[model samples]
Target chain A: MTDATGSEAGTAWRRIADELEAAIGRGDYQEGATLPSSLALAERYGVHRHTVRQAFRHLADRGLVTVSRGRGTQVTAPRFPYRIGRRVSMRTNFGAAGISVAGSMLGAEIVAGEAEACAALRLEEGAPLWQVEALSLAGGIPVSTGVHLLPVARFPEFDRVFVESGSSITAAFKACGIPDYVRLSTRLSARIASEREALLLKIEPGAAVMVSKAVDALPDLTPIHLIDGIFAGERMEMVVEPFGELPSPPAGESGA
Target chain B: MTDATGSEAGTAWRRIADELEAAIGRGDYQEGATLPSSLALAERYGVHRHTVRQAFRHLADRGLVTVSRGRGTQVTAPRFPYRIGRRVSMRTNFGAAGISVAGSMLGAEIVAGEAEACAALRLEEGAPLWQVEALSLAGGIPVSTGVHLLPVARFPEFDRVFVESGSSITAAFKACGIPDYVRLSTRLSARIASEREALLLKIEPGAAVMVSKAVDALPDLTPIHLIDGIFAGERMEMVVEPFGELPSPPAGESGA
Candidate 1:
């Protein structure tokens, strides 16, 4: 621990908390492991006990550790890892991780396509779309919500197929005679949840969420559908893997 | 607009805000376009002017639009799109978007490898590693901060080469005789920015930040380095593209 005497109390405490957080992340304190006593930490950092206590409070607030009356601060379990690859499927990903997964249809309807959906599906303006909203659960805990939009002309009665197949989009595609599809692209952003989303996900209104907008395509690069998903940030982490070669740059410069 | 008679004022306002935000995102209102008047929106939504005003306030607070005395409300410019792919060069990505990019070295040192770095680099315990901290700027504004860790033995003069090459990690790798590399995997999460990170990125403390942990490797699968980056959530969007075939699934039954 590096001590700078002139730093403010808040900065000092934050620095200490950051160090401890990094340590916990590095598995210095494994899952369910208790941290050292406040007095010991203070002595190690050459700070007052109260300062160490403040640091511990900060860590607890960040959901990194839990404190109880009888027990000391204990680290929380690691988050579940979800890999996004060429043939991505939420069911298969969580199943391989030893977590049972299920999907339930929240609602389904035919609606006017939004510009994003129209552009991604190459539909003209005013095209009707089959929109399906569903929630995915891992071990019975809601982890993500998805809104999928497909061209109604291409996949008529998609909602019926989706519901009849127990809310599996993959199965619904097969019902539409599509054997397989590939992920075309994914755009990621982060923001705080809205009031309605918070209620649905059972989290605070301003809690963090990871948002992804993705388009799936057929093997020949024809888009099939577009999906917008909001994932609970604390419950899942997204892993991205390379699935194709980088597009080569135009030739211009000579070899160095 | 869908209206529910018994909904709370907050819920109604949020609904209006959500609709307007979706419109803006879909380019119904292009960048720098002015939104409809509060009176017009109120009438369209069958709500009072004050309710529409509240919705506008919410949009402003979320950095989606700006309201002025004479000009009314105007949407802001879209964020820079950063595509994460097989090559995954920030310079190339920003250049294709016509944005001038620059990087500056914040700090560098040789430190004992942590678990993540050691595991990614396949290094033994207590191995020394070269760590570099940098800030990437797009159009003269800082957008991301990166902490890169590499094996010291592989690139002994990495720090000097990186600084001399105008803070280009790709150039430094080339200087070390590495002609090409590919991205192996990327993990993404979102959280509130810490005080130090907020200061560095010129954002408010506790604002949302997208964090990515990625490993780059040689063509034959030898890991090169690991990068942990924090991006200002509101300033940039990440685009993930597939670069290889997904791992084949085990033998299984056909369709249901």
Candidate 2:
């Protein structure tokens, strides 16, 4: 409870922030949910809206909420502990977060391997490759859209098998006799999402999207898959535990 | 040289793409610079603009160029190989890229440590701390803007010392008797930049910016600094080598 009886304006905001923090801690305001408008809060507290804004700033500085222009203040959600280890599987990742991922298969075709994919797979130029497009969802929330390029020589009809496995890449790999694989390398960048990507992810066209280019390899370190992923930035935060469970590679070679 | 003589429209784009790739390899067109407009390229090659666009798409798929709607196709710049290791230093990173970083100090003040910084630094809430703001540029290209919170008890007058050291955090640490420090933990996300941040980084407002929250600790694992960095995402790429040079941490605790 805050003493609203003519307290100093500075301490007035402090008390408001304290009360809001307690409410948030009690789960009255859920994460990724907006709080009352400044005017509304001000009316309830009998203080100026500026005081309410000050309180919001305090909470934002404490990492409990975020304040953006045009968008009201919202409770900050705890970022998903996205692990970027050798084995990078979307299903495994969301499952670890206590959420089941529903994967949807998008465009699938047999096409000539592009130069980038060919180099990563160590195949000759114009090699026949299976190109598969897919999306992963957690609790019906789309997480990422990816394009997978696999050498047709290695897995003759991976696209069809992928759909047959309920869009589970792991199941498809297992069906193809790959019991285990490791992510060889991953490069991360962020940029404004294009119209097509935003439409697929159901986000604003100008929203941020994290672009990841990764290569997955077989147990023997043979490149098997080239993946390009576009992730809705606001929905995910990647945690890279570089040396968490794995030992360092040999000198002059890192994550090859 | 590509034969301008009539050929199948399909392979015509292929030959044009090959020639442009060779020109790029020869450094005729530098990274981050746009090529001739499609109309101009079409006139030169005696082909329709659609054929030139097809060529652009080929190069884009090959990871050599990026084609945006308004901005013409530009050779993709090699992203800075930003390494996230136990010891993270912007000066060291740009230096390795053969570019010297110029640091500019912004707002600096003594402030009460907010909950987030206090929790990271193991200080009491409202603990007195020195808040320093700075930005780093590489070859006059702004790389990142950061706000650092350091315990005033440990590094009294550190802000003044930082300014005295030519706005170099590394040099200021040395002056404060901290010969070396290691980055304890890092968390990364991306979002649209604020107007002030965009202006500071000289990027367009609403552009994507990678946000990093990190803690730097002394050699004995005592956190000394809490850093919040906003990076211009288009200019940088993060390379996280989890197990590149370091062995695994103790079980159950990683990157502590």
Candidate 3:
């Protein structure tokens, strides 16, 4: 679709890919829907078939479409929107969305806290900590791998409770007598997935993974645990909620 | 740098890299500091120099270090911590950190709001909107590029005001009589940088970039604007604040 002025040159393929992406975004192309054939797209755009093929390649590379031999290109399902808020829970969020979710402990160990984890949890370096590795699955597809660290002294039986409670961190916290907790801070970044991460998340090596380093705290803002999660970028998008009252505008700050 | 159980086979290089990363995290290597030489690291880890080189290569790939001949590997400076909260302002955030911040309008145009933008702003399909493209500089380095959209009819001179106010979105909002606004929601994802984005943000092509789609609303929760920003992943990290009182724990929900 051309804008008001017209399409820019040398970006014809990109423009086509963007148009197709927008179409998908608008729900014109639903999951499992087949995209138009290259010949048809070429005719519609008045471009060569190769150009349409290039556009298809672009879409496929973006994880928007999957092309198979003999079958036409099919639009991939959209990522689940997971909200990160004060009372957020992975299980509750996925369940409320009518998605079957499950979590399983991959491994667990007790080790001295690393410097970063120690600072976040307000513990001394080399303090004993429980490192729990877990995987979250949505509809039978692994979506994230999380490494959680907690002060071992505070939660002596954390690993046992986590595994026994069906890998629910909330359950483990409750077992440890922490009835409620809130997200204190979350830092967001991204990088190419490592081989191990890609294997756990079922994505190709070097694929983008959204990394979140988050801290959970008690009602009094006492830090409880630190979690670093590697989420399959194409499988989910993070929705963050900002909490608190809006601040009043500064005087004389408006443009006149 | 081996753990209690010892490093796994075939992952020694990764383990060493992780140890170095943690050391850096602990400030063993400050910004602008050069990491230990590969030969020294190799000897310390009881590994061959090639393994050390591989570790350095991995760190460089992650944008944590830059390796150049003769000068040794240098750690990249840490990015500014940008807080996304009730009153989120790029200029204000960097300014409070004692960093010189500036923004400039790269371009502006009136275009029909795309489906996603329209949905966020609650406008009719194809509604005319002013799209302001801006670049944010912190300490004279380009850190982010933002494309902000507002209903054209509501802010007729938004582009001019924004440009004249030194590219401050707050000033344009004030010009439109919106004294205050709050961040309603933000969605974050990541993707490989496009060539144009790489050039604009001064990052290498194919590098990871953090993408955020945010909605800002009035105090009463009426959506006013939408922004899609591409931030250099290696250059900045997003910090978010949670709003509202902590919810009481659900009865009988904790593990016994």
Candidate 4:
């Protein structure tokens, strides 16, 4: 084990990668700036050329850099924070940040909820839900392809509002007499996007997508929204802030 | 735009990919089963061989299958679930799930708190803190790398219990007469693992790692634990439960 300097410790490639990563993070290599060739990196770090390549490969996989066959690797443009911290609608969240939220209605139809959908929304089996598939754009660039489910009984005007406004579904619910909502739970998974999502997001089908499944509740505690968002992992960041009160001490416990 | 399961979609490769993905998820081909040849898949799906290849590439990128030029693609074995859901200790969470938890103390030393560390633990800048690094294993397989920060002034005998038990930092706190703690907040991010963490977790540097920064408070609201855990993305899963009271309707509006 080594100290924070990360020298004389683990595998040579790893040490090289750490130092290089810190350098990149510290803005030693600005966005779109070409990184050193593997040979040059090897010479500087005193490691095999392949070690540097492996390090670069790692950075490429994390969407931190771009590597070309003949041309040298370059640091990637950093993505803006796609805030997923609050219970706000995706459209409003971006719109509030002055980013235009635009996407065509890929499809809009009433369908029997899938088993996974039923479980997430806490609805009965085969409940009818409006499954609206759409893509979300940030400043006219596709950033995510997703599907949102609303219980048909709860949002009777879903299709109408969806086609016209394409804004916050929760806000639309407020217009329909449900003013507010709360997010219940979320499940996160990373996977290769489906060919459709990839095409919509303008990335390779095998590209990573960050999948989030959330259950939202109406003011009366009724589950109304089960949103399944699939974001181009290369384009977005999901944040979570957990809250809780401190545990109480046993009776007569001293402060010390 | 493509409608649900209809003809005249934008791309044939996407439709083929979706069908294959659903089939695989539904267990049409079990783990270790070889998928049909690209030529055969093209014939069956009425698409070009290149389309099938594209579909397979998507599967491979998600680590769902492995492809050999001559042998075709085979379903990959599913990985174990790396639980990061609850506020429980790493040892307790894995142990209660009947998974063995083991780790080697990589390094431990008393040091002045860094700016970030001080802010996290609510300690004065440059205050003495016990910094410990460890690599954790589950079922004899490395899954996470962690660095812990403990205020030395609060736990005067921190080093002794850490070396003796090596099970959990929470247990160490109990031995120091501080019990009943609550997790205050947890912030998560996806990042490339440092060289040291990559080596410890048996993943390549630059592989996506789930980073969680958490602060723990004592029963009496004294900040105690500031933990930074890096979990191997291939194995980790974080299930977050968000609970809040739903908002009520604004003054007296009946059904619109």
Candidate with maximal lDDT: 2
What DockQ does every candidate get? 0.25, 0.26, 0.26, 0.20
- Chain B TM-score for each model? 0.73, 0.81, 0.76, 0.74
> What local lDDT does model 3 show for residue B243?
46
lDDT of 1 by residue, B140-169 (tens): 988999788888899898888888878887
Task: Kindly give the stretch of ten consecutive residues in candidate 2 chain A with the minimal lDDT sum.
Answer: A247-256
lDDT of 4 by residue, B1-256 (tens): 2255443432676566657767777778887799889999989987779878887876674456766546679886655443333254777667777998877677777777755566567667788988778788888889877777889888776767776666467677778886667666554545545566678889755455666656777755457777777777657665555553223223212111
State the lDDT of candidate 2 residue by residue for A1-256, as single tens digits.
1113345887789888978887887778888889999999999999999999889977775456877777899998865656777688888888875898888787777766655557678888689988788888887988788788899888987877888888888899999999898877776778877666788888877888887877788877778998888888888877664435322122211101
lDDT against the true structure, each candidate: 0.75, 0.78, 0.77, 0.66
Q: Can you tell me which runs of candidate 1 are displaced by over 4 Å?
A: A1-40, A43-46, A49-76, A243-256, B1-76, B243-256
In CAPRI terms, model 4 is classed as: incorrect
| Share of native interface contacts present in candidate 2 | 0.40
Which should have the higher lDDT, number 2 or number 3? 2
What fraction of native interface contacts is shared by candidate 4? 0.26
What tens-digit string does per-residue lDDT give for candidate 1 at A28-71?
78888999988898899888988988898767644577554467
* Top model number, DockQ: 3
Where is model 2 more than 4 Å wrong at Cα?
A: A1-28, A35-73, A243-256, B1-29, B35-74, B243-256
DockQ of model 3, rounded to 2 decimals: 0.26
Pairs in clash, predicted candidate 4: none
